[model samples]
Target: MQEEEPRGWRPAVAALPAAAAALVYAWARWCFGGAAPPSPAVAVAGGAVLVLGASAAYALSVRGAGGLFGALFLALGLLSTVAATERTAARAETATCVVREVHAETEASFGEGGAEKTVYRLALDCPGGRPGELKDAPSPLSRGAEVRIAYDPRGRLSAVPAGAARPWKPALSALLLLALAAVLAAHRRRPQP
Candidate 1:
């Protein structure tokens, strides 16, 4: 009689390490307030850890859904980490700017406890004749009011009222990680063949 191969939850088990690494990376970036990009050494080390975790998961998983999950986790982890790092780094540069224009938009949400939300955007005349815009301004800005702006070295706007609030990048990353964990858990609980 032919023997059936043993079925295991290797894929789900494997995802944990990579997920944990991503969480740590997210936390570190948040701690720095996205003010500075991670040093090259830190970036390289983080990449290495992510790669190793994905590789291990890939090797241990089955050739179908398990492999797909491993790859998905790896890709998401890489994207989130790189995005957080780059965005934070870019925002490290700062300049004092004068508001030239302000625009506001109101949107209605349909989700549970739906409500109307307003977003304010600002156009600024920065020092040295540099033009900049602030998306999601924390408060309404008066035209000609002086304010601090964070930007990339390339002169692109990054943040308004520097360090006023933490960016949403980390929160999005955490949500993605949480969804991945839930999927992995469900996969692990499936009946083995």
Candidate 2:
């Protein structure tokens, strides 16, 4: 049975966009280079848990529903936060490393942009193979060419080009998420249309 509460809440729908984005990002990561490797069973299990948790929240809006939603929000929030931090660190850790490999990587366009842009995949040897540790990379990187790689000491392999960090990216993303959440919470207070 639906929980008795104010009618204007649509937090569930509000989360859909981010969830969808995450799903797409995950798919892209999994499908990188056409040599997609099987995700560990644990990842599937975790995804299942998230789904079940959301469903359970929808089903039982009693006392714990808010908590469940909060948990979900935290989960998504932390993921973005971590990614942002990792990227920042990676950029700061940029070091002069030889590009062991470079390959063309194609990514699908988002929104209505029905266009494809070419990107490159670079392999840099870091102190350790820590991922998600780069923010911006210097320009003109090529295979066998020495290029500056910014990476987090914690993550080395996930380093990208030096200028990849756009201050607006995370700022805009967080603002939108908060705005949507606020709108949904407000809607939840209104009678369901």
Candidate 3:
């Protein structure tokens, strides 16, 4: 058996922040539903509510660095959730499209190292009943090249390169945060030597 957190109180107390974060996150999601993404101001307000609520719950029960870390996790998880939701909502379909035209333009990069880069602009034709355009596409694309694209079948979102948006990212981040919180709680609850 593990040497730490043999007591039940530690686990119980540690679960509070995660539970609170989830509850607040659910409430925010319910408030928004499946509608379009909330405005930046609204999203910020919702995030503040989550951070404040979860952090307060953690701080009230446990007095230590855990509260700050818990708040960090909560903020990161909520941000991820909002971003994934917005990305998924923005696109509803994927298709293999062919590049109709390619325009390669060279632009100077202002990075720490002075460099020049080529930007491939492409016009793509898809079998999804509409043509699409992609800008600053990665290299190796030419006329009649087939590239995967994601778009809104209802024409709500313009087509973008595949993998540009991921819907499952938030879930993964939340799971990781919960795991970290559990570990932190167990460590903090260890008996003093």
**lDDT (CA) for every model shown?**
0.61, 0.47, 0.66
Scored by lDDT, model 1 comes in at 0.61
Clashing pairs in 1: none
Give residue 157's error in model 3 in angstroms: 6.9
Could you tell me how far off, in angstroms, the CA of residue 106 lies in candidate 3 after the best superposition?
Answer: 12
What is residue 147's positional error in candidate 1, in angstroms?
A: 0.9
- Report the Cα lDDT for candidate 3: 0.66
Question: Lowest-scoring 10 consecutive residues by lDDT in candidate 3?
Answer: 25-34
List candidate 3 stretches off by more than 4 Å.
Answer: 1-12, 20-40, 83-90, 94-148, 153-159, 162-170, 186-193
For each candidate in turn, give its C-alpha RMSD to the true structure in angstroms.
7.1, 9.5, 7.1
lDDT of 1 by residue, 68-105 (tens): 67456655655565555545553656789999999999
Q: How many clashes in each candidate?
A: 0, 28, 0
Clashes, model 3:
0
Please provide TM-scores, in order, for all candidate models, with all chains considered together. Answer: 0.56, 0.48, 0.52
What is the C-alpha lDDT profile of model 3 across 28-99, one tens digit per residue?
564444366566577668767776766666655555687567656655665665555555554556889898
